[model samples]
Target: MGASFCSPVDERCTCSLQSTIHAFRFPLWAVKVSDFLEMLGPPRPHHRLQEEGLLHEWFPGMFVIFTSHQWLSSTHPDPQGQQMEVLQKALRGMIDGSLQVHEDLVARSDRMNLSNTIRQHIAEGFLFFDWFAIPQITVRKDGVNEESVKSAAALAVQSIPAYVELSNVFIALVPELTHKDSSALVNYASWLSRGWCRAELWCRLLSNKIDTTVIVIHSPTQAEFMFPLDWQHNSIVNGNFTVESDRAIVVQLGETAVESKIQHLQVHGPLRDCRFYCALRPKLLCQERADRTLQKFLEDFRFGSLEQAVKDTSGMNAVMCAILSGDTGMLRLLAESRADVSRPMHGLNDLGYYDTQTPLMAATKSHQDPAVLTTLVELRADPNGRASNTKLSSLYMCRSAGHVRALLEQRAELEHAALHGAAALAGPDTLRELLSRQCDPNHILAGRQERFGPLHAVALFSLSNRHAVEAAKLLLEHRADVNSRSSPSDEFLWECRKARMRVVVLGFANCNMMTRLRASMSGISPLGYAALVGHGQLTQLFLDYGADPTPNDRGDTPEDLARRNHHYHLIPMLATFAT
Candidate 1:
């Protein structure tokens, strides 16, 4: 509606909030950033700053004294440098406390990452586990091969140049990187990025392309993939063509190459399984729900219904479940009821699964009541039955120091069976004993990507920052492959990042860790990972071992990731190279 000389009262007046007008004007001093943005008057202060004697009365005007006690950075608030922190604190208070919604303005800004700025100050809130700080390998107590190991390690490290060319060779193949060598990769890319896009000249991640995939089925438990037939020859996300899935988000690279060499490849021409290891009809999809079925059986000594369980005497799983549960009465009843005490499990994809052993294998995984295990043994259950499908029998399940003395038993080597992947899941002590018994370290049982032996299994299992130190120690004493390319994904780095674990500072000739370094996508080794997540000592260790401060295709290196991830303590680590 228009009004010309009041022809018609303008309807525009009915709408509220014009900046030039005010029913009751107020000073801006009492207003908050939020209230001003809303274009609405704030609620009256409980007590005006002047009324509360909180402000100094100047000749004509007065103002509130912004004390540092109320705001840590009040005296030196660097708005540009600390905007993220300020916004995060304010947002948090608004969400959790008294601040009212600043709807119109709040919806416009993105400040989630700003919160990470403050988290940078805290320590130890984020470690997934503490086992990462410990060493993974150890020396054999018996000293059986000490001299041989020393000779091998010294020969390997001394033969290789200190500053090896990363682009030209498979560092993992060097004898210096053999099992006895003690070096590992440390990744810390997040700290290096510090949350900003890198300069273009340093090499931006233009894009990553993958148009090929190969699938292979392995029973009901797992599956495999091959990007190129020549796995040994390739490395990178889609690099030399073979590997299996680890977790959902692994940052893997096969090898390092400048932009030019990456463009040319021989396998651009050809391509290559089925059944979802699933509810997916394959073994993996809806696999055992949290190991609950096993957990329950181990706890209850019986299934949901004891009656149904008692009738199946030869059911190896039922016996094993009873033993794992350590229910002496249940075992007594089962054995008295004529259960086949000598039967073993049938699902031996490897020694880890469907292992044969009527109920003996069950007891191995369970630390149940000793009486139940003894009862099963007294009932003539085979201590050395042919296991599910492994190289050794059921006796090796008692690898624990306690279990070993209890059973005086048992063990495998099908390095590359279809169950080869599962074989990688074997226990460290169990494998160590087997290797001590002279099992071939490089034996390929069924289908294995890397023919390296038991040590690879130990290192891979320690990925979660759990059992890594002990696992590594056992492998080292036995001479596990330091540079061996294990399961192909870059998962080791992720676990390192999560825990900020530090690897040993073994010399470079022993840099079997180079493959692990190259396999990771971001410019981080496990040490870099630790630094980004705020582990200073880990950063030092990796630097000593020569963790390169190189960035990936994105020009975001370990130092960059650490800062961005709010691992402020690690920022100074890079200063060592700051000439």
Candidate 2:
């Protein structure tokens, strides 16, 4: 078992040329899940595993689980064996059918389940963790044979994509933990921003495997299929790399992976997916847009003619293509050719754009150029159009001050919705613009049952935005209440009950599930909302501004919310404030 090697010439090996060469040099290494679970005190180094005769070379039909994670310490992946403990328990629960992976919260309606086949695979699987598979010279600097070590390390580094492609399952181990050196909170958001992590993600998602589901293990008890839009938002070119020079190489790898995916989809006859990828190719590659003639545009996007393109209102229709490609001229041409600029988006819910999103809304949410928004408005796009599903206007999706100005210039309303939206989704510049226009930072919707304000909006929806902290600070500076509370009315409770029934129907029940539901449906403070989502920075910010650690209407305090969600790292901080 330990001496086997998967043949690089196998028909299943469809890695790129560069990846193949590197893989051929180093081959893939893994350790059986059963063996790994038994021999763990602290995370053992690769050499230690090898010396114990535990490491195994990959072979055909072997079930491989590729684990991607961030290092918590400078010299070790997990100095306290915290991550390994979680993995161990998760694996145990999975094998015993105690743990069930579900879809993310946004897509809970899909009710994607962890198949019994995957559970069986986990029972007899091998894990390909970086620290356990690759040689670690960077941490062990005093080792002998420096030159030989460098050669082997380089080979393993370059072969990562091949290993990713070969794996049967991809698990992102992104438990919220604090970085020992930088004290930064490392979680799903930070993991998504990493360049190498993105590269690996693209490789696995783009692979020719039948099942490309990415299981994101947030905690031992909280694992879900990754949201598709998470990868689309975190482009490899925009990822952060510890060594800046690795950016170019990793970006090239990303391009190859995307191109490979597109080709595979083209042959596989998922024509809708093929068209979507073709339309998003340039944006994904971060390439400069070149002027395209009408015929060239039609051909590049695989449209039969302008009529077909204009009439289609699917996720990647002609209007969407133009918006995503940054082709404003083409956008005007489409509108002139009878394309509905305000046509609600369809079939893109998986990508997070949501249904009923108009072209202007899409452009705004995507952080497209200000010129694109101006052009859409000039082309008679609805300046105040709202998504039918969420009732959020395009103004609420403004990513910058330019977007706000463009909409306002077209007579878009500057109401409480705009301030709330900007507070949760936009940066300081956009908030500044709205505040200058005299939008009330503390205004609650008149005659509305939900008491959600701008501050509450910031707490609930700004988890993924890098500028959220700054946006919250700006709102506070503009006299927004630091201790704003959200008190849902009877109507709101009815709505929550309906949603809760849906969750119950989906078989999503746990020990404290009712308590959590009650707390969420009842009134909650901004600090409570922050703790609920485990936004460490936002919680700290709210505490610094004198936010009270009071319980909600359901008698669940901020600390309770944090613990219910398995945000253990936040317990200490919230406890300090509670005391």
Winner by lDDT: 2
Candidate 2 lDDT over 137-210, as tens digits, reads: 86444555777777877889899999888887788988878888999988877888899999999888777664
Q: What is residue 250's positional error in candidate 2, in angstroms?
A: 1.1
* Model 1 stretches with alpha carbons more than 4 Å out: 1-308, 312-321, 328-333, 340-358, 369-399, 404-455, 463-465, 487-579
Q: Model 1 over residues 418-499: C-alpha lDDT tens digits?
A: 1112223334555555555555544433232223344333332222222344544454455443333323224544543332
What CA RMSD would you report for each candidate?
A: 26.8, 5.5
Alpha carbon lDDT at 95, candidate 2: 76
The list of candidate 2 runs beyond 4 A from truth reads 1-25, 93-102, 105-110, 138-144, 445-451, 490-492, 495-519, 577-579
How badly does each model clash, as a count of residue pairs? 73, 0
Per-residue lDDT value at 92 in model 2? 78
